[model samples]
Target: MKEIDCRGLPYLKIIREIKKYFNSIGEGEAIVIVNSELGRSNVLRYAAHKGYQLDEENEENRFLIKIEKRGCLEVEDEGEIFSILITREKLGEGDDDLGKILMNEYFEVLNEYDKLPKEILFLNSAVKLFHKDSMAMEEIRLLYKKGVNLLINDTSLEHYNLTDQITFGEITSMYDMVVAMKRAKKLIRL
Candidate 1:
């Protein structure tokens, strides 16, 4: 089996390297070693996204993920691929406190939905909602656990001085966000 040592690499780099390696082979098995949880999560998500069979083992200081890449599995059509773009901390304008409450309620309802969006892109002040102390953190975490891709704006995190405070979601660039938006069959902006 091919071995890809991604230990100590950043999450994005780990993904890029793994993708490159996988694209080079036809049908094969490979092992990926990563040190950080973020890196491990990214790799496993990528593998699943590509319809690869995976087996994971946690060692003392790192994770070993075995991926068996055959032909891509047939995924049933699940209707239009939609995404949500959130640009503010609240749902609508007006009173700040009321907006916060409305936003919290909005997420709570969204979490209870049977069909969730393909992803939720957080930008501007919306990035603040992913911070550890955010009121909607629980709902957000639940959405994440339910398989919603949470993409946060990297620049917004820096602007709000919350780059390190964010505990969930993937920090992504505007280019990546734009690509995601373009790929979505429908987009709900707020």
Candidate 2:
């Protein structure tokens, strides 16, 4: 294993960088080392929020990573965990207006949190937020601006004919969804 030096990057930047590496390489792992415990924990918190786990042996204030294969990453760090569960269409079922109200409330709740959920995964009718004409477009845009990751189902996009128009994140597979959910600390369903 190579001991890479990633000393100066911010937590989110490093996460994005690592994700990029994973994208191009299709698999690999890197240990994230920061100058301070706060930085390490900040990164760790996001990992945990996304339902990622640590190697049981990792000590507090440190980050450990060991690649299991080409594409899977295992990170261990000591920090609080948070989870956000989104498995629905339009934020809720039944009345459309009520669902809109609830979706706004969901976004507002996330806005108030000190540490938001690791990601917002959309499936089925839930993928509507990415539409250019969505009422929640601004709120979702704000969330993305704040470093929240957005992932929509690849097949869902095909179903809705949303393969174009969207200028955000990526289209993801169910396998990726499983990994995301596994890293989340708590899951909130709508």
Candidate 3:
């Protein structure tokens, strides 16, 4: 069995390193140690997404995840994999305050849906929605907790000078955003 320690790493780096490790190994078992709940959740999601068998053990301040890469298990199709694209701070053109209210309500309603989008891509002014003080922060965080990939545009973050104010989501490039759009079964643009 191989062991990979991922303590003190960001969630994205943890996922990336684990992915690289799995790709390099053959049929074998590996143990991943993570110290944060977000890291643990991301690892579990990655394992499940790849159809790898996994078992988890909780320790005093960390989680020990045992992953076995025997073969990919058949994953049943759950239906259309859609993505939501937000290009503005608000939902529609109108009074800024009303638009803010509408956007907040929209995310709140989306949270009630049985099947949420596979990912939510934030672009342009929509990147502001990820700021720690944004009104929609709660809903966005909940969406992430529910396994919806929150992808924020890096350029937009820099444009708005909000790169450090963001509290959730992965900072991604325009190329990644285009790839996600192309791969989505359906896209809901806002």
Worst 10 residues of 3 by lDDT: 71-80
Count clashing pairs, candidate 2: 12
Candidate 2 vs candidate 3: the lDDT winner is 3
Give the better candidate number (1 or 2) by TM-score: 1
> How far is 157's C-alpha from truth in model 3 (Å)?
0.3
Please write out the lDDT profile of model 1 over residues 99-184, one tens digit for every residue. 98889988876874446999999999999898777788899899998999999999999999999887777999999999999999
Clashing pairs in 3: none
Could you give candidate 3's per-residue lDDT for residues 31-85 as a string of tens digits? 9999989889989987887788999999988999999999775364668789999
lDDT of 2 by residue, 1-190 (tens): 4333445675546566554554455444556555556666665665555444433224554455432234333343435555454555466568988887778666765664446656788877677777887767777777888887888888788888987857886679989977887887765555
True lDDT of residue 131, candidate 3: 73
Cα deviation of 182, candidate 3, in Å:
0.6
Candidate 3, residue 150: lDDT: 91
lDDT comparing candidate 1 with the true structure: 0.87
TM-score per candidate, chains pooled: 0.59, 0.53, 0.59
Error of 2 at 136 (Å): 1.2
